[model samples]
Target: MATVTFIPAPAPDHTASLRAAVRYGVLGLIVLAVVGSIVATLLAGMPGLYGALLGAAVGGGFILCTALGVLFTAKLPATTAGAVLLGTWLLKMILAITVLAILKPLDFYDKTALVLVIVLSLVIVLGAETYGVLGVKAPYVEPRAAGDAEPGEKDAQ
Candidate 1:
């Protein structure tokens, strides 16, 4: 019988990760707003500029909060790390909901445009963060042995 062992994944990455996340997130949010404005203008055109502004506010607020949370946690004691991060996350959710609730009932803008921009911003920011984080180098994985042949190749030889 042969033993099969699996190696564990890498550990926490650098603070540069937050930079990458926020950079990409902001870029995506900007693109969403521009494209959304054009489309909304051509379609419903129901005071779209304000809606797009509101959506940008929502997305930008989330990104800013997350960046602050990441920075704050990195400086805290290990025992309180989890608690701080969770609390920040809860705060962000509540703030987002409150913003939406307050803005959705307003008659000055198109609700559909605002909703679409907010949803797209969330998706793009998430994708950017995942992509950016994955770009960080994994420094802990040990190098492979030199000239090590596979078991099947050795048997064939």
Candidate 2:
């Protein structure tokens, strides 16, 4: 007789959903980065290339950071997790503004290419994360009614 080993499945919970979302988000970012780089380069040469890279890093990284924050705080209390997520959101906004301000006067990168790639990255990554989150098979428990007989119990004769 052959011996068989079975691996336990992961729990269907917030962490599982988060892990899926993060995995898909990273995949989306990578795909966007590669395609954006190629397309931008063909459109505007080296400047376009630089723009696409910057856009992918800034846009994708911004959203990815939020997912990571939630994943990191999955085990914490609900209020604490919410607070951390809100804080991260604020920080991301500040960082985005600062980055845009710094890049405003610099002409080394193609602005149009940067904007397009940023928008595309945002849409694609967000869609991918949404898909991932929706794909998880979360377990559901049905509430038992009052006065229900115990499982496997027989009524008195």
The TM-scores of all predictions, comma-separated, are 0.69, 0.82
Give the Å shift of residue 116 in candidate 1: 0.8
Query: Model 2 Cα RMSD, Å?
Result: 5.5
- C-alpha lDDT of all candidate models, in order: 0.73, 0.90
Worst 10 residues of 1 by lDDT: 137-146
* Candidate 1, position 40, lDDT: 74
> What lDDT does candidate 2 reach at residue 15?
74
Give per-residue CA lDDT, model 1, range 37-89, as digits (tens): 78877776757877776776687668657766776676678769778888888
The residue pairs in collision within model 2 are none
| lDDT agreement of model 1 with the native | 0.73
